[model samples]
Target: MKIHEWQARELFEKYNIPVPRGYLCRNADEVRKAAADIAKPVVVKAQILVAGRGKAGGVKHASSPDEALSIAQDMIGATIKGIKVTSVLVVEAIKPEKELYIGFTIDRAMRAVTLIASSEGGVDLEVLAKTEPEKIYRKNIDPMVGLHPYEAREAAYSIGLSDKSANDFTSICLKIFEIFNSVDADLAESNPLAVRFDGSLVALDSRITLDDNAVFRHREYYQVDEELSPLEMEAHAADLAFVQLDGDIGIIGNGAGLVMATIDVVAHFGGKPANFLDMGGGSSVESVYRAVKICLEQKSLKALFVNILGGITKCDDVANGLVRALKESQLKIPITVRMVGTNEEEGRKILSENGIWYLDSMETAAEAVVKSAYSRN
Candidate 1:
């Protein structure tokens, strides 16, 4: 799960990462108070989950308490990418002689920790990857051995630091890696890791994404759960993996592979999927209801594509669950059903007799859903 910047900075401080002194403010008064207490030029940053805050006017610089208050007042209720900025971070500004980027994340392809570093920092890494790929460097780290001191030094040197600074930077990288492992973090990054004129380093910004599966072991992290959406909370509670998308077609399939194939089929048929819902082997009425509710919550949705190839699950059971949901839910959207294998005839009969559209092929269902959704749109 993604935590706010304040929470991420707190975790970074705990891991011995040097960060600027800052105060989390809920209102403009608190922002002024923080700036006055610090008695220095400060940066006012809006705290929100979305990225590109700068472009959205969610970040501003203040040279005095009055300026801080003004910026905070203007930012507090402002919307950044549709998310309201409810809090701000007032941090003492720093003078940087140089800026660098450093981050650690799990590389699923390599099944190992990967370190990303570059001389270019304070900018989105994806933009760098797309525009100047050669400027960035990636190194695979063995979790078993951890980020060794020698390796860290080499990485720092590769990023073009001096002898002393390289060693110091490497030490910092090692500490950050230790934090990632200890906290079970999925990803952690410090953008524009600054080298001050006095030869010290500090994190200008921090981001941390915790492993949701490991949250059970970190109760403290769970306490900061105000950022979760209702659908996300429901998906977590049901232990049914789901992802919400932006489209008009809701899809439910039995297998992950089948779900992906269904998505491809819908796209090919000129439709976009609203969500990825997998009922899996549990074709029970409760599971179906849960899946249907998830789909129904998508206000843009106009049709559902229920494609199930029942192996261990009976087709009639799937049909019955769908019928039961239709009876219970006040959903107005149409559903195009596609059932195959394990008493398929009964499933077809059940849907057909009820006047629910049942297609014998996935392609037909996709075409029908696309047409239905387009007409509604």
Candidate 2:
């Protein structure tokens, strides 16, 4: 689960990290009031989950309260990266003498929480890792021992800070790591941690991604909102694992591994998958129908691929769901199905009777669906 920048900043404050005076504004009036309260030049930032907001014109400078109101009005209903912006963060725009990137996240390869720092900041860290690898400094903390103050200082100095500035930076790093552990977060990032003229550090931006598996431990922080898309909400309501993607072919499978493999297969055949929908074990006809209906509702979907290697979920049951859905719905997109386990013969017979075909080979089915989707396009 991800929180907006304003929420992340609140968390930072709780951890004793300094952040600019800011207000979470839901409307133009609130933005104007916040700008007046700050009594300084403010930055108006659209609060959306996706990145590249600055490049997408979601961040603007407001020199006066009226300007802040105007900026807020412009951003409130604007769409960025396909997500509608409903709120904006109005904060004092600090003029940083220097900018640095500092973050703590799980390094899957190292199997430890890694602290990353860089002299260069306010840009995509992935690009920096590829282009100027030397600029990126990394320290893998022993989870058993946790991050020590000395290690945090080492990271700070590695980024070329010294003296009082180094100490301040070290404190900020330690606090960020503390926040990461306390929140059971997968990632806690402060991009472009700004250094003011007085050498004080402030978090200009923050991002926190909590581990969904640990939500039960942090119930107070878990609140459902309109941040999720409609398809995501539907999947959540059905208790199915699903994620939307940017493509034309909708994918459905019985397990996570199977669904991922199906996506790879589709991509291998020069096809892009629209979504990942896992029906999970012991999937019923209703669940399958709902999944299919959700996929069919997606605009620009040329085809759907259902690959099920059933162990607990019977193949015939899946076939029954698909047959019923096709009969009841007016889905124009083509569908390719491959079922290979648990009463396969009965499943094939049912599909054949319903004027639908089943494939024995995943590779062949993937190729057929890719061709079918392209032909329609």
Candidate 3:
């Protein structure tokens, strides 16, 4: 799950990490008070989960308390990347002598923990990786031993920090690594990790993304970030696996592999899938209904293709879920369904009686779905 800057800073504080002094305020009056507490030259940051906040005019420099309140007022009600900014984080501005970037993330292809650091900071690391790959340094961590002192120190030195800040930098890196492992996070990054004039390291920006499967171990940490969009909040609230894509046709299936195949088959047949939605194995009617509703909710979606291979998931249950969804949601677009295994005939019969379209083969289903979408266009 994604969290706002304030939430990430709070989490950092819990780990004894050095973060800038800040106050989260929902109103202009409270913002003024926070600005006063933090003193002049504060920063008014829109508390949104989306990126590119700086480009959206979500971050502003306030030279005085009055300006802080004004900037906060402007940002609190503004929208950034479709997310309504209901609050702003008022933080003390810093005088940084140097800036660096440090991060820890799972290297999926490598199947190991990867630590990355760069002498450059305050920009998208991906862009940096593409343009100046030599500036970024990466090291693999052994899960059993954790990040050793020598390894962290080596990363710190590699990022171009002076020998004086090397130990402090290593300490911070160790703590960050601990946080990543403790929370089962997929990524933990701090851009512009500043070295102040006094030579103290502090995080200027923080981002943490936790593994969805690990949420079971950290339920308390799963508190919803108030800055998320309504659609995002609802998707998480419903616990439906969803990934937004860009295409005209929406493809959904019961398994992850099946969903991938559905998208691939559609693409092979000259159709682009708008999203990959999976109901997962052994889902109920409510879950299935939510999956369909979520898929149909996409404004770009021209049609839905549901392909399910029932082994542990019964075909009848899939059919019943589709029927219930059709009854509940007044979906105007056509849906093409393909069912295989375990009571497939019964599922096909149920769908036919409900005025829904069904096909036996995956290729035929994909063709029908693509045809329905293009026909409407």
The per-prediction CA RMSD against the true structure, in angstroms, equals 2.8, 2.9, 2.8
In model 3, residue pairs whose N, Cα or C atoms come closer than 3 Å (at least 3 residues apart or on different chains), thus clashing, are none
Check candidate 1 and list the clashing pairs: none
lDDT of 3 by residue, 262-304 (tens): 9999998889898878788987777887888777778877888
Give the distance in Å from residue 351's predicted Cα in candidate 3 to where it truly belongs. 3.6
lDDT of 1 by residue, 313-363 (tens): 678888887887777776688788888988889888888877887777888
State the C-alpha lDDT per candidate: 0.84, 0.90, 0.84
Give the residue spans of candidate 3 off by over 4 A. 223-236, 244-250, 272-274, 293-303, 327-333, 352-357
Off by over 4 Å in 1: 223-246, 330-333, 342-357, 371-377
Top-TM-score candidate index: 1
Residue-level lDDT for 197 in candidate 1: 85
* Count of clashes in candidate 1: 0
Task: Give the range of the ten consecutive residues with the poorest summed lDDT in model 3.
Answer: 223-232
TM-score of each: 0.89, 0.88, 0.88
**On residues 106-213, what C-alpha lDDT tens digit does candidate 2 reach at each position?**
989889999999989888999999999999999999999999999999998899998877999999999999899998999999998988888888999999989989
Report the C-alpha displacement of residue 26, candidate 2, in angstroms: 1.5
Rate residue 136 of model 1 by lDDT: 91
